[model samples]
Target: MDFLTSSTHLHITAWVVALVLFLVGAFVSKSKGIHMALRLFYILTIITGGALFIEAMDYGMGMQYGIKFLLGILVIGMMEMILVRQKKNKPTTMFWILFAVFLFAVLYMGFKLPMGQNFLA
Candidate 1:
């Protein structure tokens, strides 16, 4: 469906789902089911995000797009690090804090950047 490939729809939908899953994992107990679900959401977010980046390339935004792509990967990495630390019974506070910071950064960039057809557009 055209809607599925549309950058706006895909990015927003994936991020919203990922954010909800992140909240659940952070605030509530992390169960195996939740972990798998979160992984699925992460994959979906990356795929959709990559698609958005490719589409945005046509607009010739240059390094901004690349930076967001890398930051997005870091955000995902931070999330995985948080979960891994938790599973290892290690100190997750630092990872959790970093995750939050990176998440905020990604969100700020996503909203501020003139990339896709956002809701305000």
Candidate 2:
């Protein structure tokens, strides 16, 4: 839809909300309800991210966008891993570290890319 491609608001909002949900799921509560909601936001984030990826291809920056995409997936995977391991009462120090690193990488690339929004640049 035009609204999706017109801006990155949806993608940004999805991830931001997901991050909040992740925090709640990870620290405040281990309820399945929060995890399920987080999963849904993950889907929303991916869909909007895919739209942006496709748009980036038109600019001949497929390689960079592709890397960003992979990093995004890693971030998502790390989030899921942290929550699951937390629920299982296992230590997640490494996963938490990786999550922060990957999330930072993805966000940096997102802002550095030649998109409608580039707050970092």
Model 2 residue 102 CA deviation in Å: 0.2
TM-score of each: 0.85, 0.95
Residue pairs with backbone atoms closer than 3 Å in model 1 (clashes) = none
lDDT of 1: 0.77
Model 1 ranges off by over 4 Å? 1-4, 116-121
- Quote the positional error of residue 13 for candidate 1 in Å: 1.5
Per-residue lDDT tens digits for candidate 2, residues 42-89, read 999999999988888888999999999999999999999999888788
Please report how far candidate 1 places residue 32 from its true position, in Å.
Answer: 0.4
Instruction: Please give, for residues 1-121, the per-residue lDDT of candidate 1 as tens digits.
Output: 3455564777788778877887788669678787788889889888888777777777788578878878888888888888777778899888778877887877777876786545444
Residue-level error in angstroms, candidate 1, position 18: 1.4
